[model samples]
Target: MTNPTALELISRSNRLGADPKNTNYAGGNTSATGTETDPVTGEEIQLLWVKGSGGDLGTLTEPGLAVLRLDRMRALTNVYPGVDREDEMVAALDYTLHGKGGAAPSIDTPMHGLVDAAHVDHLHPDAGIAIATAADGEALTGTIFGDRVVWVPWRRPGFQLGLDIAAIKDANPQATGCILGGHGITAWGDTSAACEANSLWIIDTATAYIAEHSSPEPFGAELTGFGALAEADRRAKAAALAPTLRGLVSTDSAKVGHFTDVPEVLDFLSRSEHPRLAALGTSCPDHFLRTKVKPMLLDLPADASVEDSLARLQELHEAYRADYQAYYDRNAVDGSPAIRGADPLIVLIPGVGMFSYGANKQTARVAGEFYLNAINVMRGAEGLSSYAPIDEAEKFKIEYWALEEAKLQRMPKPKPLATRVALVTGAASGIGKAIATRLAAEGACVVIADLDLAKAQAAAAEIGSADVAIGVQANVTDEAAVQASVDAALLAFGGLDLVVNNAGLSLSKSLLETTVADWDLQHNVMAKGSFLVSRAAAKVLIDQKLGGDIIYISSKNSVFAGPNNIAYSATKADQAHQVRLLAAELGEYGVKVNGINPDGVVRGSGIFAGGWGAKRAAVYGVAEDDLGKYYAQRTLLKREVLPENVANAVFVLCTSDLSHTTGLHIPVDAGVAAAFLR
Candidate 1:
């Protein structure tokens, strides 16, 4: 059970973290001092509950709080290491734990415990940062809040910075908060509610000041040809450029992508000062950790052709990599961790939009959001005075800090298909849905492409959240819709890596009973549809230069010569050959094409439920309910094959064991002696 004060602290932290105006995601810390009975001593003791390292305040829980004894923590001042040896203090914090520490203490822990207050909040709100980053920030602080909010000089967050803030608070008895130069803000109160109000007051006041003083064009006048294009044009251009950009940024490793052209981003990109400000990089330590030192600007006009932009993008990417390498070499010390990577996490195009990449989708999205925070800070700072961020050397110290490296190393090993993206057609129900669900479970971002948009979206939601999967409308028979589905995969998850051409229907009609329409309908949806989807997805896979997978849900009828199934069998055969042909061609580019033959996936199968089951049961002279058992009896193994069985086969083909296996068909038919491949 949580104490009343701790509960108030949680509530206050959530309210502050929930609003972007208050703080960026995971960019702040909060704490409360309270009394709790010691489990061993059974005596009331003072404790400090502060937001821990690597935890987001918005979603923080009990486990995310670091528990320390106030007496032990405060005693650190006696043996306090100076700024030069502050890194050691972080390790020493573990010794101050009151019990099983809830979480590892963050570097900002001292600021909360040492300050003379019962409640403390450390936040990187854009409004406060704007004043903090201004060239004349100290002067601006005095002007804005007088003695109420004091100003602290720029110091990398450590034991010493906490000491500085604690000393400042002690001297200024009337102060509610202090603005850390070129960093952020810290507010305190004797009570949790008072602390929250004081924090909000500081942000709201700073915001109002910036609004009153800001120039009409904080980012400078709009660049003529670089302003945002029409909505349609911007999207089309973004789609065309996404794959190429994804490939470039993925050189170090594959990354999931997020694209946004929100007014704030477009407004900044369109301005003349964007290039200069972007070069200066983000000020807050939290911002740069995810976004890298700086972003890669496209350096092209909004109206430029995609081909022209793509050509220049390659050139710019090379330069960006070289610059990043140099930045790493310039500041690396004897004990600095090895260079993580030379890839740009965030890419900015003048007209189209911004593309941010990460090992996964949510991270990419959050990185972009953080950059937006930096833009807001830049805007406010320029309005007050020249924007001056922390020095580059300081950024290097934080970025390559051993503590930061340890955090990265602590991340769990990625799943087999962790960074891969897959698109499954006809995924609204049955086998297709099963395949999409299984792929998502294995960590592949999935696209549920189906004719029914609503059902597709519902399936996507059931399978996972937006980052794990998305649903898009696609009619395989229509060439445009097929292409759109492939494009949707790229837009949603960066680029397509696996495509399952599973959109199909069955017409269990004899040769004599089949009409031309039946033949064309089956052929168009299964045969031509596979070809169309394959071609569209292949373009992206090839451009990504990251070997991918394309699997066809072919049938045993393709080889077994099943009776009363001319249209269905012939279409399945067409799909089977397409897999072979594509594998031979796409193999040079590392895209593997394979096929899975599942015999009579009747139970839970959409096709079997949609009229085909009745027709097939009639031909087999069995009741519809008994058809599955009858089919299993005829197989060599006599085992019933379910939708998940087929889904499992698809998963295996995409795994590393089959990396070199392609143009081959694996039967998920529970064994069929007659349908053996010749």
Candidate 2:
């Protein structure tokens, strides 16, 4: 086959990266060297296209690639200021741009460019790392591939490591790849297919060899009394402890969380070797950067009761923080990024599972995933021989490396609601849907709770993936359902920070026309529902010790004294007061309660669509289509209040702009005179 183009290089990367066994998220790089017509010179020029810094290969596009002149990149070898000043090489790479540089070049660029091959792949496959981290890794590499694949000793990733690998290939002309000691593996070939095949061969051979030489109990046999809890009990215990864990972790910065109870994790946790191996921490730089230098394991056994675990968690968390701080102090030199918080990103509960935290749901989930990769590496290494990860000092150097710090600094500033999770009731449509969408856009993971399960799920999909929004079936009036919804928020995104009590209906009935059932239904859906949702949410908010928001979506009819709105008006009034009561009660816990009063949201309103719009239109002696216009004309602003307008109010009240304001009702009714707060 002809030498692969940049697109084929991306295709190969996507295939290799799609599997967790091959590489963890954003953990590897792939490149192809090809001649392209120079945009200015109209002459063929050799360019290297590789996966960009901080981008996942599976989702990589042309724009996500860094294209650099291969000649300029190779020329970096001469000017390299040795390993002591290796970091300067990263900045020096910027000068090698082929054109208007695409994505920023990753440090791994040299690994791809310096190799004398048309195609190259650098991956952190668990199997390869398992071989790499084994105490006899160099000998094992020779035995596994019989000189077909070489072994390169541990070296920090930079220009030097790249040159070292290139030298290894030069010495062993028959080698297709090399196992990176205490790291991962790299492969190269004349074509993309050949390169990919070589990578898979290394990974697959390492895996089979380990299995062939594996011990029966790699983690030193599962402890007799240490096993996972029953499924229901496990979930309950996880939910109960999540809020406190979230609170402790978020002390420095707010974090969304992800929980996993996969069998592999449970099995590893149940083993006697878990504590020792976990303490040694993960081996790969890709793994530890996300999982942290090491995981914090609950000292208690798997069989410990939830209450006991909860009581012990605080003490353990404090100890972990102290230990982490010491680690930082021991390794941090002057100008090192001031200890990026002392909290553990991965929290291990033997019987329960793992809880990982990050700035958002996807990040939190990926952290957990990286930990799982670490687990597989441990399994393979211990099964083959003693697991020998790089020393902590080396790990610390990589963790606090200036290049890593620069990468962190380059991340965009987070949105106001980043790391926050909101549950908006009645979010399947209309006002509730609008609020959910807006909050997600502002960086909050939203839970779309509605009576209609399908619609709620559909709305959530429309907003984003499971990380951004989730759908939960809830009839807000039901206490059990309400609690379940709150618990869903906790499990889905760690804990809840915002609640919009928007699940409501309108009953346009006069005092004489309204039946007792009508009053009960309206009050049950709005007033009682808001109370139920708030009560459930407050428990989490208080437990988290993270300030929260509970906004009631009341109506203008609550105080405007509109005709034919007795039941709905009374319910709205009750909802409005509940906000004040909650604000007063939850203030000590830093929970803010507020309300939004929107008047006659006719366009795209479930309440209005459910016959209320026609009833109000008939009452006002206007066509149904003209109802919004009629309502708008009456307001001082003479503008119809859209569902988006109410959503905007919720966003404002939840942001720092109103951090000191509570028990307040913002009118989203286009300047309604009668609905004005007194």
**Which candidate number has the best TM-score?**
1
Q: Write the residue-wise lDDT of candidate 1 on 1-678 in tens digits.
A: 787777787888888898989999888899999999998889999999999998887888888899999999999999986887889999999989877748899999999999999999999999999999999999999999989999999888888999999999999999999999878999999888899999999999999999998888888998999989998788878888888888999999889998888988998999999999999999888899999989999888899999999999999999999999999999999999999889999899887788888999889889999899989999999988888999999999989998899889999999989989999999999899999999999989999999999999999999989999999999998988987888778777778899999999998899999999999999999999999999999989888888899999999999988789999998899999999999999999999999999999888888999999999999989999999999899988898888899999999999998889999999999899888998
Best-fitting candidate, measured by lDDT? 1
Each candidate's TM vs. the true structure?
0.98, 0.98
Q: What's each prediction's clash count?
A: 0, 0
Model 2: number of backbone collisions: 0
Residue runs of model 1 more than 4 Å from their true location after superposition: none
lDDT of 2 by residue, 130-203 (tens): 99999999999999999899999999998998898889899989999999999999999998899999999999
Global lDDT scores for all candidate models: 0.92, 0.91
